[model samples]
Target: MAENKRDYYEVLGISKNADDAAIKKAYRVLAKKYHPDANPGDKNAEKMFKEASEAYAVLSDPEKRRQYDQFGHAAFEGGAGGSGGFGGFDFSSFEGADIFGDIFGDLFGGGRRHSGPSNGPIQGANVRTSVRLTFEEAIFGCEKEISINYKEECSTCHGSGAKPGTTPETCTKCNGKGKVMYTQQSFFGTVQNVQTCSACGGSGKVIKDKCSACRGSGYVIKKKTFKVKIPAGIDNGLSVRMAGGGEPGVNGGPRGDLLVSAVVSDHPIFKRQDINIFSTVPVSFTKAALGGKINIKTVDGEVEYEVKPGTQTDTKIRLKGKGVPSLRSSSLRGDHYVTLVVQVPTMMTPAQKEALRAYDEAMNAFTKNDEKTRKKGFFSK
Candidate 1:
């Protein structure tokens, strides 16, 4: 029995020295070409798929591979590798259980483990939209009501798409399976595929006397309002997902997600990075020189900040725990960075100009007053 069977490597079109990746790659090619779902009613393709699957099962397992390499197909026969599915052993208990599932998913969009019927439930597609928010609202989470045209089952025929007291007929093209199998010749071999029936659009039903409200789609569009909660510290261009808020599912499947991307308006004074907030605060020269309390604008509102004596322009200071709240926990906050920019007075009265001269004389802000000091100083200063 074992001598009559094909070599594992030969079945997969690989060499004895082929590695795990090369083995898997070769098997995937053969499996896609001869999958039962793709080539429905083809015994030859089904036999080929099972043979390739059996070959992959042995090659993918380390111990099985070593035994095969040493003793050939005889390694698993006559109580050597146990009894009986492929190669006198249970190929079902192989190492790579998910290999076939992943491969089939890549080729057919569904795993081989379940291989649900074509007319079975399928998750709906996601719905996407943008929402504009004020910078402050983005920092401190806020909720806004959004309106969209939501699809749901039609009320006229209770989602049947047929007129009252009427029923839909089974799709003739797919025979109510809603999918059709087709084969095409490729460079490697015969390439078979499964696609949604063009006539049924995967619905598996057809309606002649369609409902006027939903036509034959079995769905209706109506205004839907949702209160979307914009999370704190959610950066611009980032999306918030609302589960089961998208298009209605097909064949009793679950609804998809609603992805809302935030479009935050630029703040006049504040800018954000991750959770931190940054802004420039204009400090009067006197306040910077003498040190005093000044009101600084923040997302939270105006707060008094103490200016250090002789503080220079562009001096940065941090207000701890005063930035945007963290997404995980609102109590965990970031710091607000304030850049102190000393403002020079543009307009001055005669009295103010005289006061400034007296102040300049008293402070001696200009060190290059004397000729000796001027000669020792920088060329421009």
Candidate 2:
């Protein structure tokens, strides 16, 4: 019906230069007014509804509208009426279900019943869970077993939800079509409105006798366990992902992924930052002043380090490649920083006080010499 010419703007009951919102508003008003349910058995109403939907669908798309404005009906029409045409536009390419609903809601009671439940192998939803690990387990890496409660395919019915020795039958209501259609009149013309069959939940099948175990849901809630390897150097708030370890899908769909979030326990001795370990080491004031070798503790055991004479408090000593192993690269590791704090004497015995007095007497000799020299210079001046 390419010869049947009617301006798209006229079909949508709008002016030639309708903005997006104006075009949308006009389409809504016209669609509701000419809906099939409002004027059943009216040919003119059905024809107008189809024409309005077609016009709005094209003009709403910039590319389609540009081509239509530039090439007229010939933009979509093939030579001598082949597969595509303007007046005979294909509604299958229209992807917006909401817009489709606005145009055909009244026709099918506000439902697009033809598009049934997704049948192709649909992947299950991704599952999220948490795991708690000890500080050592996180640093050294460990294998852990985690428990989870999830939906599993029912064993009683072999996941079909059908009782033993029986199987689900095709729904007799929709006759396996998964949909039912009814003819109605709209502003456009006669229209056949389709809707999902309520009897089968759009599966197009029905269990004549439901299974006792799963109750025909094809799945059951069960506790499951999975083993996960915690890589070394895994920090708090880190996450591990396991593919196909989540809940199984419906109708033989691919299984979803399992996301495991780790909560690492606090370490009493060592603190970590991005594969680096840090700790405080206390040193005696004598060791810091005179310099000596001191033994320090590590996860690998004790190691000795030389402290330089006159070492200041809060000085840091780094042990190269002595930190946690990298999670991304196993062979790589960070450095360890040991912050030193000089400890002053809190209490001294009489012997120590005597020794300190003798040391002060030796230092006073210089002061006495300086004082004598200054007096002699004063007299000479």
Write candidate 1's Cα lDDT for 157-188 as tens digits: 99888998899999999999887766554322
TM-score of each: 0.68, 0.63
Best by lDDT: 1
The reply for model 2, stretches above 4 Å from the true place, is 1-117, 171-204, 353-381
Q: Give stretches of model 1 more than 4 Å off.
A: 1-115, 185-190, 362-381
Summed over model 2, clashes come to 15
- lDDT of all predictions, in order shown? 0.82, 0.78
lDDT computed for candidate 1: 0.82
Give the distance in Å from residue 272's predicted Cα in candidate 2 to where it truly belongs: 1.2
Candidate 2 residue-wise lDDT at 346: 87
Best by TM-score: 1
lDDT of 2: 0.78
